[model samples]
Target: VLRDERCTNLSSLIFATIFFGNLAFRAYYSRKM
Candidate 1:
């Protein structure tokens, strides 16, 4: 349980980063179109 807390937070942060990054990339591509 001790390590799980840290892993969960890190995993969520990574997921959030990727999600936002993809949204941003899509916006950029849309603007170019």
Candidate 2:
């Protein structure tokens, strides 16, 4: 159960990182344009 929770947390963290990264990249590109 603990291992499962850890995996879930890691997945969520990765998802959030990707989400934010995409947003940042979009903003950067928009600024450049």
Candidate 3:
């Protein structure tokens, strides 16, 4: 149970990082254009 919880948290963190990164990239790209 503890291991499963840790894995879930790690996956979520990674997902959030990627999501935010994508948003930032899009914003920067639009600004550049």
Candidate 4:
């Protein structure tokens, strides 16, 4: 579907996924330590 287009939604989704993942990871590590 996004084969020929610059998909901002896709990038945004990826960024959000990574951002939340990092946030959760940090929280987990901080809680552990």
> Could you say which candidate leads in TM-score?
2
Evaluate model 3: give its lDDT: 1.00
As for candidate 4, its clashing pairs are none
The TM-score ranking, best first, is 2, 3, 1, 4
Using TM-score as the measure, name the better of candidate 1 and candidate 4: 1
- Tens-place lDDT per residue, model 2, 1-33, is 999999999999999999999999999999999
Q: Which regions in candidate 3 have their CA more than 4 angstroms from the true location? A: none
C-alpha lDDT score of every prediction, in listed order? 0.99, 1.00, 1.00, 0.88
Q: Write the per-residue lDDT of candidate 4 for residues 1-33, one digit (tens) a residue.
A: 575345877788899999999999999999999
User: Which lDDT tens digits does candidate 3 get at residues 1-33?
Assistant: 999999999999999999999999999999999
Steric collisions counted per model: 0, 0, 0, 0
In candidate 1, position 22 carries an lDDT of 100
Candidate 1 structure quality by residue, lDDT tens digits, 1-33: 979999999999999999999999999999999
Q: Which runs in model 2 stand beyond 4 Å of their true positions?
A: none
